[model samples]
Target: MSEVLVVRGEMQPWTDHTARQPVLAALLADVIPANRRTLILGPHSPLLIESVLAHSADVTILVRSVSDAEQLTETFGPCLHVVAGALDGLKRAAAVQPTLFEVATDGVQPFEVVVAADGLDRVLGYDSEHLSWTERLAAVRSLATPDAVVVLGLRNEFSMLNLLDRRPAHLRHGDDEWVPLHDDPTRPVSVDQFQAALPWPAQLYADFSAHTLVGVEAAATARPGHLPTRLAVAALESVDTPLLTSTTEPLESAARAGLLPAVPTSWLAVCNAPTPHTLYTHSGPTTLKATATETGWETTVGVVTPDLLGTVGYDSTVVPARVPGGESVETVLFRLAAAEDVPGFRKLAAALGEWAEDSRVLLRWDDVIVAGDTFAFGISGWVAPESVDKDDLLAAAWLRFHRRLVDGHRRHPWPPWMIGDELVSTWLSMSGVTLVDPTPATAPHVESAYAEQLAWGKQLAAALSVVLDSPEQTHPDLRTQLADADRARLELTELQGHVFGLERTLGFRNKAMKTRENRIRELRGQLQKATTANNKIHSSRCYALARRLAQFRNPRKVAAKARRILRQNLNKLRPAS
Candidate 1:
C-alpha cells in the first residue's frame, strides 16, 4: 500500500513584499497560455496562481510542508493538485502515469512550464551554505519537461540602493519568522559571472527597484521610469563622488561589459531553453542611444544590445514631467540641455517642475519668521523660467520686504519680516514689492501691480545687492569700545590668575605657621622641665657643692667671659629708650 499526500487546511495570508502578486500576475499572464500544464515550485504569489486558474491552466503546486499544500488546495479548490514534497519527489512522480493516488500524472506527461518565483534564495538559502546556487538551478531544471519554460526571480547584490543607503531595503524582513538570515555572497558575482553560471543562453534586462525576474529565452524588458536610461546613468555616475572600489567595480564592469545596464536597482535574465510555450511578441530595440536635435532631443528607445539593435524605433511623443534640480545654474542648464535632446520631454519637464517647486518653497518657513509680526501667506502655482537670475529675484524680494516695513509703520505699525536668501528666492517669483495676495485671482489691477513690482523690484534688488556687497564703515566710538572691552577681558583674566597664585601662597604660609606654633610649645615644655630639675638640684646640698667645685675647677677668665656674654644678651633684650 502506497502513502497518500496529506494537505493541511490551515495557513496564514501571504505578507512578504517579495511576494509581489500583481507584477507576477501581469508577467505570467503574458507568457503562459490558458491550457498549459504548469508546475509552481513555491506558492509565493497566490494572486498569480489564482489569475492563471481563471484561464483554465492545469497547475500543480509543490510546497515545503503539508500545511502549505492543504492551504493552497483549500483556497484554489480540487483543480489545484497540491503536492507536499521535495523537488526530487515531484521529478519521480512526473516519470509515472496516473495511479489510484497520483494527482498531476494524469493527462499531462510533464509540466510545460515551471516557475520558482520565490527565487533561488528560497530553495538554496541566501547564505549559500545549505545548497549551492548551481545545485538549486539544476533542481529547478529537473522539474520541467524537456521543453519547459522556467521563470525565476533573483536579487542584485551590487545594486545602487545597496551602495548609497548603509542599511539597504533588502535587509528588512516581511515578518519575524521570515527574517533573511542568509548573508550575501562574500564575493558577489557580476553579470558575466552569473551568465557563466547559466546552464543555457539568456537575455538580461535592467529592471528598476524590486520585483525583477529571470525568464527563459526571448524575454521582454520591463517599463522604464520617467527618467531615461542614458540620463539616469549620467546622473548616478556624476553624483557617485564617494564611489568606493565595491561600488565602482560593479559600475565599471557594467559599462565595460556593455551587455548589462548601468543604472537599474535590479536586473532580469531570460534564459534560452526551447519550450512549447510561446513567448510574448514585443517591438522596439532592447537598447537606446540619446542624441540632441535642433528643436529637442532625439532618443532611440527600443531593444538595443551591445552589437545589435532590434526592430523597435524611438517614440517621439514622450516628454519629461519635471526637470532635475542642481546646486548651480551651470548644472541646471546642463540637465535642461540634456533633457531637450532626449526624445521624451519627461526629463526636462521633471526638472522644470522641480525648479518651479523650489521657487515657491526655497525658504525654511520658521527661520525668517518673527513670532508676532506678520501673518503667514501660502504661495501656489509659482513657476520659474529656464534662465532664472537668482540674484535679481532675491534683491527684488528684499526690496519688497523693506517696502512692507515702511507701509506697515504708517498703517498697521507692524515690523517687517527679516528677509533671508531662501525667502528672497521664494518671493522673487511674485510681482515687485507685493506683500501679500489674499485671494487666488487674476485681475487687471493685479497684473499692473505685478509689472510695476517687477520694475521696482529690479531697481530695489540692485540697490540691496550694492549695500550687501560693500563693507559698512565702522563707527570710531564702537571700535574704541570694542578695544576697551578686549583690554578689560585680558586684565580680568590676569587678575584671576594672580588670585589663584595668592591662595596657593596663603595655604603654604598657614601650614608653616602651624608647624612653628607646635615647635614653640615643645620648647616651652622643655624649659619648664629644665627649671624643675635645676630647682631640685639647688634644694639638694649635693648640687650646690658640685656647682661650687666646678666653679673653682673652671678658669676665672672663662667664668668672667661667660658672665659678660650673658649680660650682653640680657641688655640686648631690654626695650629701646
Candidate 2:
C-alpha cells in the first residue's frame, strides 16, 4: 500500500546514488523525533531510509527518478511515501504547464523532521527550471514545518580531498553532474556561513564518512584519547582517496589552528537537536563506539556477537569498560615534551615505568588515563595475547609512540638528530627500563604489527616531509625521491649479484695460476737432476775417450759408422738364424 507519486517531466534513465554513511544515519536517527512526520530529500542509502523508518512510520522520500521512487516503494511497502519529482514541481502552488506535470501536495502535511544529508545537488530534474543553491534551500525549507529539526549535508569544495585531487575537472564528475551549480553565489562554503544560512541554531560537524563525525569545537581542541582525536586519526589513516600527498600533517596543523572544520570532506548541520560527540570506528570485524562523557570517554562495541578478538590476533578475554576520570597520559606527555619540560617528562616516565612493572597487559600511553596519582585504562578490549616481560612490553609501547611522534611531525624535547633506536633507548632509560634487544622471536605477532606500523609511519613521514616551497613542486619531488630510492635499491641488489659472480670467477683463475706455477717448479727440479746425472756420466774414465772421439769434427760420420756397424751385426745374426 506504499504510495508512489510521479510528477510528469521527472528525469528518466537517471538514478542518483549516494554512499551509505552509517554514522551519519545513526546521528540522524538519534535526533529524529519518534512518531513524527519526516521528510527525506534526495537519494540516500536504503539503510539510512530504514533507520529513519525505525523511528517514524510516517515518512516521505523525494527523488527525481521515477524508477528510484518505484524501487523504494516496492522495498518499503506501506511504510512510507515515495515521491518522484523535481524540487520545483513539489510545491503545492507549482504551475501546471502543458509540457510538464505538477505534483499535488494539498493533502500532504508539513514534516516535523527534515533530512537532506545527500545535499542539494541532485534534487533537480533535467526538465525542471534551473535553481540556484539558495532557491533550492528555500524549496526544501518550504516543505518543513516551522521549528522542524533539519539535518543538512553540505559539501566543502575546498576540502583536503578536493584540493589534493589530481583529476582533471572534466574527469572528476559523472554524467549526473551536467548541471552542477558550483558557482552559485548563495551557497555556503564554510561552517560559519552554513550556520548563518540556517534560520535555526545549528551544530556543525565535520562528516568524515561513516566512521567519523566530529563536532567543530571538539576537533579544534582534540587531545589524545579524546573521541575527536581518536576518530580523526582513524579516519585519516583509513583514507582510500588517491591524493597527490598525505593530508596528515596539514590536517594536524589545521586542527592546532582551529581551522579543521573548514577543510573536512563535508559538513553536517543539525538544527534543534542534541548531538553527541562520538567516534564509530572498526577494529578488524568489530565496530567500536566511543562517546564523550563529562569524566572521560565510554567505549563499547556496537554489535555484540560472539567474541571475535582471537581471530583478529587479539586477546580472547574482553577488557571490562571503566569510566576513567582523568586526562590521558598521552596528552600530558605530549604537553610536557612540547614545552621541553625534561624533568617532568622523566618523572612521569618513571612513574609509568613503575606502574607498568606489575601490569599484566601492554600499556599504551594513550590508553592510560591519569588523575593525580591514580592511573586507569581508558580503552577497553585490547589486551596482550600472552604474558609479556615488563621491559619488552614497555619497549614495544614506547617504540610505537616514537614512530607516531616522528611520523606525525609532533614536536618533542629530544634533539632533532636523535632518532630510531637511539632515541628509543634514551627514552627507555628515563623510564628505568634497560635497553635490552627484544628480538622478534620473543613476540612475533607484536613485532610484526609494530614492523607494519613502522613501515606505514615511515611512508607517511616521507610523503609529508617535503619542503613547503609549493605543493606543485613538493609532491612531485617526494614521488621522485621515492622512485629514486627504489631504483637505487634495485641497482644495489644487481651490483651485489655481479660482484658475487666476479668473486667466483677470480677464485677459479687464482686456482689455475697456482697449479701452473707448481708444474713449472717441478719441471725445473727434474731438468736440474737430469743435468747432474749427465755431468757424472761424462766424468767417468772409460767414457772420456768416447767423448773425445764424439767431439771430433766428423761427428755425423761417426754416427753413420755406428749405424753401418749395427746393420752388419743384424745381417750376421739373421744368417746364423
Candidate 3:
C-alpha cells in the first residue's frame, strides 16, 4: 500500500490536464539518479514515474489535485508517496506541523534528486500564494540536497510551433491556467538564459517534441543530411498541430541561418549529469539513439523486433548499430541536383550502378552511405522477401527518389517537360538499365518492384497533395510549374466546352430562322401569281360588258335588256341547230 498525504486548505477545484510525452520521459529516465530519494513535481506521464521508480525505490510525487495523488498511489503502490497540496501549503505545513510534513517527505531531510520536467506552471494551486518563475525554481531547489541532481524543462514562448500556431492565446488557454504565468519576465527563453538562471552547470537539449531531442551544439551545426538535420526535419515534418503555414521552409531557413537551436519548441536542462552528445528520436515504432564517435556513428535501437519494418513484407533482420564511415548518398545527390551539375549526377549514377551490380544489396539513396568509392547500407532493418533482379531494384529505387524530389519541390537539371517515368527512364539508362518505356500499366509485367513502388507512390501522393498545393512560395521547380500548367489546362478545357455549347445553340437558332424566311418567300410568290391572274380576268371584254350591264339605273331596265339579249341568243341558237 502507498502513503497518501492530503494538506488542509489545499486548492480543491484545480486539476492538471497536461498530456504525457514519451520522448521527454525517456530523456528524463536517462539522467535520473539511481538509488536516491527523488521528488517529482507537478503532473507527469505515468511512464516517467514508472521509470523513476525503477531507478529509485523511494519516490515522492506532489500534485495540486487530490484525485491525481490518489490515482498515482493506486498505480504505483507502496513504492510511491503521494502528496496532495500546493507548494505554499506544503511549505507552511513543514514549518507549523513537522510530523505531517515528515509523512509527505518520508523524513525531515532534503531530496537527493528533484525532477521538475513538467515545468513550474502547473505546480501552484488556485488558492495558494502565486509565485513567479524564478520563485518557483527557487522553491524546487530549496527542497533538494546540496549535491542533488536536478532535471528541468522549460517551454519556449517564441518557438516556431508557437509562432505558427493559428489559434489566439486566449482560445488555446486551458481551465488549469487560472493564474497563467507564461509571460513572467524571469522565465528563461534561451539556452544561455536557462543556464544562467541555474546555480549549477547545466547541459541543454533542444526539444522539438516528445520524440526528438538534439544537443544544442548538434542543432547549431546541422547540415543537409547530417543526423541532427535529419532528426530535426523529421520531427518538424511529423508535427500534427494545425499551423498558419508549413514549417518546411521555415526550418530550412533556420538551419541555413544557424538559428535552429535557439528556437526549439522547448529546452531541457540537466544539472549534475555528464554532457550529453547523443541525439535521441523515435521514428515510428523504433527508438533511434545516435552518438558521434571517432570512427563513425554508434547507433542503438531501444526495441529490436520484426514490427519495426511495418508492412514491407520482409523477414526480420537485425541491423548493425554502427554506421559506415561516409556521408549519405542522399546528401551528395541533393547537393549535385541543387547545383544543376548534370555531368556529375550522371557520373555518380554510373558509380552507384556499378556498386549495385557488384553488391546485390538493395539500394535506397538515403540508406546508402558512401565513403570514397565504397558504398554500403547505413541504417536499415529489412531484407527482400526473395531474390529480386538488379534492374528491377535499381528502377524501383530511382523511381521512389524521383517521387520524393517531385513531392519536396526539389530542383533538378532535367528539362522542364521531362517528368514521371520518362525522367526515371533517363536516369536508369545512365545507370546501365535499359527500359524503353515505363508506364504504370506495363510496370507489373516488366518489373514487379516497379508496380509496387508506383502503388505506394500514388497513396503517398494523395496524402501529401494538400501540403504540396499550399499557397506558400517555393522555388519554381519543374514539378510545381507542371502542376500549375495542369490546373490551367483543366480550366481551359472547361471553357472550351462551354464555348462549344454556345456555338451549337447559335447554329440551331440560325437554321430555324433560315427555314422561316424560305417559307415566307414561297407564300409571297403564290400571292403575287394570284393577284396577276385577277388583273388579267378584269381586263377581258366579256367581264367589262357584264360589269356595265349590271350597273344600269333600274331593275326594269336591267330585265328588259336581259330579255332582248336572251331573244337574240335564242334565234342564233336555233339557226345553229
Lowest lDDT sum, 10 consecutive residues, model 3, at 307-316
Of the candidates shown, which would achieve the greatest TM-score relative to the real structure?
3
Model 2: lDDT of residue 355: 77
Model 2 residue 393 CA deviation (Å) reads 4.2
Backbone clash numbers for all candidates listed: 32, 0, 0
Q: lDDT tens string, model 3, 186-231?
A: 9887888888999777888888866588888778876556566656
What is candidate 1's lDDT per residue for 1-577, written digit by digit as tens?
2222533221233322334445345456555656877777654657777766765467777664555656666777777877665444554453353542233534333666776655555432122234446666776765555556666655565556445433335553344224242464421245565666666565544443433222211112211211122233322433322222223234434444442343455444455433222111111212222222232223333323322121111222221212221122222222333444432223422333333322312211111211122212111111122223443344444454444333222222212342333233333433222333434448654533234435534554444333222233232223335656897999999999999999999999999999999999999999999999989878998988777768775588777988999999999999999
Ranking by lDDT: 3, 2, 1
TM-score of each: 0.40, 0.68, 0.73
Give Cα-based local distance difference scores for all models.
Answer: 0.43, 0.69, 0.71
Number of the top lDDT candidate: 3
Candidate 1 minimal-lDDT segment of 10 residues: 362-371
Pairwise lDDT winner, candidates 1 and 3: 3
Segments in model 3 whose C-alpha atoms lie over 4 Å from true places: 1-3, 8-15, 18-20, 93-109, 176-178, 275-277, 294-296, 308-310, 313-318, 324-327, 357-363, 382-389, 413-418, 436-577
| Pairs with steric clashes in candidate 2 | none
